[model samples]
Target: MILDALFFLVMAGLNLFFWAIIIAAVLSLLTGFGILDTRNRVVWTIGDFFYRVTEPALRPVRDRLPNLGGIDLSPLVVLLLIQAAMLLVAAIQGYLIRGGVYF
Candidate 1:
């Protein structure tokens, strides 16, 4: 039971982080298109918040990725990684169930 609860919690956390990344990516697009005014404090604050949240996870990927003339693929890569992690969690849960560990 405890293991199941912990797994649920971790899955929930991962799902939330996954959404955060999506939100950050969307916000980036809005900023890039100039539809959002970053000079405004509200816009700046929101943009900065997303940046701080995502940059840590994305920085290493960004560093490893070769520059492609202002195109950034790190967010897409991170999203793919997040999807893989979610799949991994589901696989582990299935494995435990298959092994007859009824947690």
Candidate 2:
């Protein structure tokens, strides 16, 4: 029971992070295209929030990846990794269920 709850919590957190990455990427695009004005306090605050939240996870991936001018693929890579991790968590839960380890 507790393990199931723990797995659920982890999956939920991963889902949130997954969306955060997507949102951050879109926000970057909007800002770059001038669709969103950073001069606005609300826009600036939201952008800053996403940047602070997502940058730590993205920084290492960005640094290791070779530059492709304006194209940034780090978020896609991180999203893929997050999906892989979610799959892993589900697989572990399935294994535990099959093994009768979850009750």
Best by TM-score: 2
TM-score of each: 0.91, 0.98
Name model 1 segments beyond 4 Å from true: none
Q: Kindly give the stretch of ten consecutive residues in candidate 1 with the minimal lDDT sum.
A: 94-103
The global C-alpha lDDT for each of the candidates, from Candidate 1 onward, is: 0.91, 0.97
Q: Over the stretch 1-103, how does candidate 1's per-residue lDDT look in tens digits? A: 9889988998998888888888889999999999998999999998899889889999999999999988989999998998899999999999999999865
lDDT of 2: 0.97
CA lDDT, candidate 1, residue 24: 89
Cα-lDDT of candidate 1? 0.91
lDDT of 2 by residue, 40-69 (tens): 999999999999999999999999999999
Q: Where in model 2 is the C-alpha error above 4 Å?
A: none
Measured with C-alpha atoms, the lDDT of residue 13 in candidate 1 is 88
